[model samples]
Target chain A: MTENPNVPVLCATGVSAIVAGDAGDFRVLDGVSLEVDAGEIVDITGSSGCGKTTLLRALARLLPGAVGTLSLRGVSAHDLTPQAWRAAVALLPQKPTMVAGTVRENLLLPWTLKVRAQQSAPEDAVLRAALDGLHLSDVSLERDTDRLSVGQQARIALLRILMTNPSVLMLDEPDANLDDASAAQVTQATSQFASAGGAVIRVRHQRTDALASRRFSMCGGQLTETTS
Target chain B: MSGAGGVIVIGWWQLALATGLMVLTGALSVALKLGVAKQLAIATARTYAQLLLLGLVLGWIFGLDSPWAVLGVLVIMTGVAALTIARRAPDAPAGTTGISFLAMLLVGTFITFVVTGLIVRVEPWYLPRYVIPIAGMVLGNSMNGIALALERTFSDMDARSGEILALTALGATPWEAAAPSIRRAMRAAMIPGINTLSAAGIVFIPGMMAGQLLAGADPMAAAPYQIVVMVMVATADITGSTLAVMLTYRRRFGADDIYLERGYRPDSRS
Candidate 1:
């Protein structure tokens, strides 16, 4: 699945968002714009409540009333169906959502979507291999997701996203719930994804800067590139 | 026709006795600080006024024998019922009131008109006596179901919206993500209709059947009428609730299967 490494896979321009709170209307993302090329890992760092998650969701088109021009793989977001565009630019939320089923069923759910109708699930061997690389080899696909720990759920959620084979990965603190080994595995996976001509945008909480090729800081809804 | 034209009559003295009982209950509520005496009084007064007005209005409609008049009344009734049902919805995701209006009007008219005009074969098709009351019976029950469905669906969204949005993230369509909540809400809404069927004749002669019998209808006629109505009402409830859940849940999600943001969530909850 490797392609030209420097292709501009996703580009955003003039994206702005406002959200209401108990206090009043708050501008969470204001005219934020960026571009992520193939093999690019863009790390977003910010203090809590600095709107990093908001910006990521805006880019993903999950935030309503977020006005922006975004193109993925040369196709404008407006021209693509939300389901179709999301299949290419997936945003992994901060908290993992588990359906009432075994891990296997949840992981295979995306294939059942009409947008992904042309695709089929990865075989069990491939899935197990990917899980093993994420330090989740011991986890059984037959295991109930409800019985999994928070950490396990987080990792499994990432695994499901990867199974979709998205071109752009928007991870909101992807390693927040992981221990050192699992976090390392997560970083390794992101690097591997980028190297395979995919793009990664991680909202990082840690001081580590090795994985991301470029870094941006979010403060008061503005995304500014950091000299890294 | 007189208000108490049936075989059994609630004479004014008997009405006085019932009023006394209600007053006693209200007094007990106030004394015990149950905090509902004022509501009890207001409800009682409103009931009296509303029923008195209804009695006069139905008497006039029945006397008129005008089909267009009856149809107009049904339309207005349906509109009010829909809005009432929607008003009970949760204040989230917007446009729920409009959804209820659409569901209630379509379901209410389809079921009510079909039964009264076709199955019952009420001569003139819009006989005010038959059409108005039957429409009320059908719409009233269906309205409850629609309201319950909207409430359940919307509240479930509040609790499980994150899960729903997560499904959207995985490239599922809005309908696919919301199908679970819609199904659950429809089931919850149908409970009352189901209960009515199970309890109908055995528990007590249903209101319509009993009322008709008291008004001098033969058992032969009353029995079939009750059966037809029971089936019609259950159908109406199921149709109303299902349509409401499906229509309203679809509106909650975005046009392109994105989860429409209601407000801010610190942790990426929809």
Candidate 2:
């Protein structure tokens, strides 16, 4: 079924989160709301601990204390199973976590999940080609993931989530550990994803958001759209 | 009772004479400035007191010869076993005590009955001499297994939060995400049972079999009893660990299928 261009591919309303701090419980995201339509690349910028990552996590339903009304393609997140909702709207955390295995296995991790079991893994040649597109031709698929540099691991983790073909991709600091060149490559890949009718919401510390059509600034647990 | 094959009963004086060895050990520990001296002395004291109390209780229960008496003692033993596990795994979720109690009570009672009623075919299924000892052995072994599994499951989930949450983000179910840790816990729980089974007759004679032989029972009869016990303990360990871990591992996750970081509540661990 074709998606209505008028309807947002992903939407969140009054997304609030209360996280346990070292001192005690504190509000992280307070009534933060946002919407992203297909082919839109949204950028969320904030100071450290400004609830940027927390908001992304809340949207993905990863935070247990988060309260919000989230919808995907006009369908309520409550209507779908969490597994189904997460598969449709995937999150790539800030830290890159690679399981113990060859790079090929790590890249194919999504398909190995039971929720994604119905989808077959792509061919190694296809994966190798995707790596080449991401300017990671030096990284071999047979190489152990632990041996990869953090930058390489970050890119591979991003590619791994993209392999799931999620409609809305939430990235937390995708370029936190990448060099300028590697960071550019990430931006290019995400731009291509957005242009292909997929939605992208990225958390960035830097002000450069060349691909974003809409920019948001989060402060004191609130999200406000900035006039870019 | 002094015949070559007959049982040898130690008098009270002889039992006191045996206490001298433990006293000597405690003294040696103190002389060597070992910090374990106090623990050693306390353990020795507990061993004597506990065994004598057990003998008194068993003597009374055997005299009563009532099925309700046997069941009551077994239930009390199961409760103690559950409490021991709950104490050992303090980091476990809130309902851990209830879960462990249920698991031990069900598996322990089932295994004990199977041994006394069906395997040995004791004349009276609830005969204290048969039922109490069998229930004790089952509950003791199962308590250790379930405790190990419970401790391992929670610790593993905490340590592997990164990998688990990553899997959940890709839509893995809670079971699928926690499967590795559960398997590891189950394996760790089974190791002692496996070792006991393998070393029973070769490395050392098991307690029940050794007691039987010392009491002048036939070696053939003691061997079958020991075999039954080894098999029973292993079976109980498997079932108890599986039940305890299955019932409790989900405590690490929320109802929305998200893994609660460090269990109980969602924190900023990641």
Candidate 3:
């Protein structure tokens, strides 16, 4: 008898999603199933319009048109309150959104929400260290997010997600706008996170360096794992 | 000149000057992108002409010292102000414009009525000269504020929708997702009113005070009234605009994300 594939830290079974309209209902994922054990980095790569972003959104429970059984550690994504689902699974969108404020303000915004309000604020030194590890100076934290370069903004956005310490991180084209240095920072961070038992699911257009535990492709509205 | 009832002569040029002043202000507002100048000019002219005609009809009514006429005119002023606000904020939800207008009337009328009726204790009939002008000023300013607030609120929500969604995913409640945008829209709405209040005396003599002086009122007397009107206008504007923005936020977002209106293009109509 085959063991259940859904026994991992995060699982999406028989997932299907559509976008735009009911008439066409452009199917993005059909009967897609995936699993990520604790402390693994999974990469999803495919051509444009291959539904990579949609799959990530589905995992985050941010896609209204997505129909599936998505669960975190055996709890159904549908059963969890939106707040609960989001706090456990966070998605970093392709185009990082920066509110008009100081960099620190944007970084600390998630903590201000009632769901995460009880969490301790990230220490100033810890925040500064994250910025530095990402090759960003402490001065960058004081500057307005709008003033930062695109690469810096991307890293800062990722770092902000890290501050919340979500169990499952779903990233869509996170490295699309990043330069070599920022991209290196992202790889390092993901490696560190995975080693620490945090799971990461990311979508990329090209095969990225330093991440290949599990790879998948979306073709004809279905996800198929690519052989190593 | 008759012996018992004398002929009360008025200058046509004085009427022309007042009309010209109203037109000039209306035109200036349009040129400055404050509003639709031509429409405002027509509306102002129409209002002035109607007021003159109303004065003529009410001359006999006031002579009888009837309080009902005063009450009727006040109600008409409130209704017209409400309608104008409704028209200005059409992009808002179906009833939002009407709601904002009603809020404006409630705030403007409550303050003006309380101050004039209870505090100032103006005589019977309450003289349209005092009540009408004050009400018009308060209502007009509040309408602009509400319109601007509604525009800013919708536009800001549209622009910052991604951030709003991000917040929602980060466990922000719907209102929590919208709070930043709401605060920003309210602040933008208050800019004009705040600027006018801050620079009232130094920037330029406001129209009401200047008109009072031209109409033979003492400058000292007009100054106090102008100050009072400015204060009342600011209060009404802040109250109405803030309420309108806060109340309309839920309509802008969904349970899980920001709801983009179908075929909605940003600032396309504006």
Candidate 4:
């Protein structure tokens, strides 16, 4: 099929996944198709078992054993190297994983990876600004990430991903465990990211005011855009 | 000093030393949480008894002066070293069994043979005294190193698989993905030997030097040998640990990049 040239930043078609186990395979995603363009925030809401998270992972090419046609920035997801794909479209998993180190070290982790090693490290001012935009104080940078509260950890996780400067950001329940003020900060940061030409795909159990654009409902592994 | 014929029988003191050694080994075992106190006590007692009996048997073998007996003892020592290494590392993969056995054999044989044969120029018939003790020292150091390496590598891999995958996704090669964890584990594996080396004279007199002195060697004469053994042990520890960690990566991760079996559960008791 001819590709859309508003050429969505991330796209997937006929993507299906099965959770492998000893008993049998349980289908998680089936023929799921969606697209997110630059400067767009796509909110995907579904019940617990509807594979919204799996679909997001499929788009990011992070889901193992997933079968589908997925692409980012007009490049086939399957053809691009994982590093290139991740640099283009990164996923922030449901439970944020913090490497054992200080906040600055965690923030600078993506730079240490060979894929992004050629890129110059972010300046101290830029990193501090990103942290500040997430409502995190400059002092948070010196604290151990493991010692941060859940809300603080979530904000730091987002800041870490943002430091990579990926074109597309897929977050699974970015606001799931956050307090009201932290959730608002996430929404504000994400909205700013979308307005600045980054694609945002968020999976949540309930819709939030954070998503100001299109909203989609995932049911029985099917997605349909709705105004509700 | 007052014994008949002025022989001054100190054999009882040796017996007491042996008893005290058993008690110390048992206490250390308990303190390390290696096993139940009673089980460790029994194991220590059995170990001392076995060593004493082996010494008597070796005395006879030495008196007989047969090449076959010497070969037999070497084979037994190799077998014991291999088995002990394997047992201490139960979580290691089957491939590691061969790796560890070969490593113990190669390192222990190379160091002991080269030191005694080429450097010391001990008589061929005197191989037992030099080769057995040196081999035992090398094998023992390698065993601890391998155990630490295997445990550290696997645990670090397990705990940091996500970080590794993140790195891989970020375009790091396999070696690059594993480099940091491997380095950390290698350092950790080498720490015990490093610490012993650092604290050698100030903290404790190593057993080998103390034993040599007890056997009537001048302290000054025994110093060089102790230093040699320490250097050899450090070499064995570093070489064995790095090799073990390198070999473990092949078994720990699958082709699809998922952790395979529980190859090296760092939490598992040895």
Name the top TM-score candidate: 2
Model 1 — TM-score against the truth? 0.90
TM-score for each of the candidates: 0.90, 0.96, 0.77, 0.75
> Tens digit of lDDT per residue, candidate 1, span A1-105?
234444478899988888875576788888888999888899999999888888888777787778989988677888887887888999899898888899888
Clashing pairs in 4: none
Full ranking by TM-score: 2, 1, 3, 4
Each model's lDDT: 0.81, 0.88, 0.75, 0.75
Better by DockQ, candidate 4 or 2: 2
Model 2: residues >4 Å from true position, as ranges? B1-5, B263-270
lDDT for model 4, on a 0 to 1 scale? 0.75
lDDT of 4 by residue, B1-270 (tens): 444433345586777887787788778878898877788677777877898897898778768777677667766766676677667766565577677777767777677777777767778834676766776788789878987787677667667876765555444555767777788888898899999999987899998998777666788988888988898899888887777668666665543343333322222213
Better structure of 2 and 3 per lDDT: 2
The digit string of per-residue lDDT tens for model 4 on A1-228 reads: 234566887778888877653455567787888878888988988888788977876676656666878787677765766667777787887777777889888788788777777799887788788888887874567789778888888888888887777788888899899888989898888888888889998998754784658888898767888874
* Residue-by-residue lDDT tens digits, candidate 2, B174-206: 998999889899999998888888888889999
Please compute and give the TM-score of the first chain of candidate 3 against the native first chain.
0.92
Off by over 4 Å in 3: A1-8, A11-35, A64-70, A76-81, A100-103, A137-140, A143-147, A209-212, A219-222, B1-95, B122-133, B201-203, B211-220, B257-270
Q: What are the candidates' individual DockQ scores?
A: 0.55, 0.67, 0.40, 0.23
The candidate scoring highest on DockQ is: 2
lDDT of 3 by residue, A98-174 (tens): 87899888888888888887788887788888888877874566798878888887888888887788888888888
Please report how far candidate 1 places residue A187 from its true position, in Å.
2.0
Lowest lDDT block of 10, candidate 4 chain A:
A19-28
DockQ of 3: 0.40
Instruction: State the fraction of real interface contacts model 2 keeps.
Output: 0.77
TM-score: the better of candidates 2 and 4: 2
Docking class of 4: incorrect
